[model samples]
Target: MKKKIWVNIAFQVGALVLALLSTTLLLLAAGAPPFQAYAAILKGAFGSAGSLETLLITWSPLLLTTAGVLITFSAGLWNIGVEGQMAMGAIFTTWMLRLLQETSLPPALTIVLGILAGIVGGALWAGLAGALKTFGGVNEIFGGLGLNFVSTALTIYLVFGPWKRPGVGSMSGTEPFDRSLWLPTLPDTELSLWSLTLSLLALVIIIVLLRGTHFGLRLKAVGKNPKSAFLMGVPTWQYSMLAFLLCGALVGLAGAIQVTGVYHRLLPNISSGYGFLGLLVSMLVNYQAVWVAPVAFFFAAVNVGSIQLQLMYKLDSSFSGVMQSLLVLLVLLGEGARQRFLRKH
Candidate 1:
């Protein structure tokens, strides 16, 4: 076991080195100094107190989304509709906030309700996908993709129609929520300590649940061999559904955090591809709960640092995305190589 662990770590480190080398080559091709660009990235991500705060803010939702992805992946489910689920969550959170923005309810209570609504919204969206897979014989991937489009359209319609800013609504999004509806942020920064705390707590809970629970073991068995697990009396279908629901709830919470803790409004692209990004994080970490947070933080830093690349090098921020894709590709290739080596030996 220890040998396997060390081998895994070595492969990851080698993959990182290769990824960086590939990214450097790309930078050179684009007429930029690779070292300088890397320096700027680090600076943008952590050079200042404000930048560090922003990094933490970005990390919060990312950690939550990735944790959710980890759960579904462990259950052998492809929950690609996390994007839609997140959008639904944001929509639900906004709906609750809009309805109660003018009420006499305490801010804390109102925010809690809004968050819960977000969770329900996400769970419902994910549940639909799970039902289609289990009962309708539809592939989760296709169903999820279709649902994602529908959710995006719905968000656009709401933003440009009934929920549009007072009048003459553009695609910008709905009007910002009342200040009182916003999540409480740390002093002198846009970072929401409440959201961050919740994210950390959720991570701890997930780690415990996945590593130390019978339900998690059953889910793993279902993923590894549903027929065998069923023969052993494990309710494979039920456990699969539970995994989907749990994933949806966490992702939905991420969406709610984005709305209340960051954007303060429901936008057409409110999800901002964090769902997809979270998928990458989950894959890179091999679904280990212990590695999710650090991987999330690294990705968040890359994302935040890309802004500096755009500003200083006049480079397209998509370069950061390229680096991310390369990292995942290299990691996958390295894993494959490691397996082949073990098989040959």
Candidate 2:
């Protein structure tokens, strides 16, 4: 058992080293000084108070998204529709705020209702995908992809049509809400303690629920073999739907944070690709809940720091994406190689 553990660690470390080596070569090929670029990324992420603040701001939504995906993953679902779910969440939040902002309701109540609406919106969207998979015999991946496009279209229509700004429609999104409706934040920064606290709380809850609960065990069983789990009396379809709904709820909360805590209004790309990025984070962590926070934070830091790559080295920020992809790919490959090696020995 100890030997097996050591082998696992060795493989993981080898994967990390290969990922870094590949990234370094790519930087050299692009004529960027690899060491300087690395230093700049580190500095941009944590060099000062403001950079740290921005990193934390980026980390919050990522935490939520990653947490949401972890649930779906545990239930053996891809849930590619998470991006759409997030957009629908923002749309619903915006809709609810607009509905109540003119009422005599207190601003605090309005914000809470908006966030709740966002959660419902995300669940409704995920329910649609689950319905398609369960009853329509469509695969979740294709159903989710279709729903994602529809969600994008919906956002565009609202932004450019009904929710258009005062004079004309634009991609700038609808008019901003009053500051009273915005989530409370640290004095001068965009970082909201409420969002941070909620995200961390969500992460903690998910970790506990997945690691300690009978429900999590059954869910994983269903994921591993639906037929066997059903034979064992697990309500398979219900569990699948529940997973989708729960994932959607967390994702929707992320969208709510984006509106009330960050952007202060809806945007066409309000999901900011975090849904998809969360998928990468999940994959990198091998669907382990405990690793989600640190991996998501690292990804967030890379995203926040990549801005300096463009400014200081004239490199496209897509370098960060490349590095992320390589790391995930190499790690997966390394895991595969390790399994083959163990089998051979």
- Which runs in model 2 stand beyond 4 Å of their true positions? none
lDDT string for model 1 (1-345, tens) is 999899988998999999999999999999999999999999999999999998999999889889898888988988999999999999999999989888999988999999999999999999999999988999889999999999999999999888999867776788998788889887789999999999988888898888999988889898888999999999888988888899999999999999999999999998988899999999888889999989899999999999999999899999878988899989999999999997686
Steric clash pairs (candidate 1)? none
Q: For residues 1-345, could you state the per-residue lDDT of candidate 2 as single tens digits?
A: 998999899999999999999999999999999999999999999988999999999999899989998998998999999999999999999999999999999999999999999999998998899989999998989999999999999999999999889999899998999999999988988789999999999999999889999999999988889999999999999999999999999999999999999998989999989999999999999999999989999998998888899999999999889988899999999999988878895
Which runs of model 1 end up more than 4 angstroms from their true locations?
1-7
Clash pairs, candidate 2, are none
Q: Candidates' TM-scores?
A: 0.97, 0.98
lDDT of 2: 0.93
Error of 1 at 109 (Å): 1.5
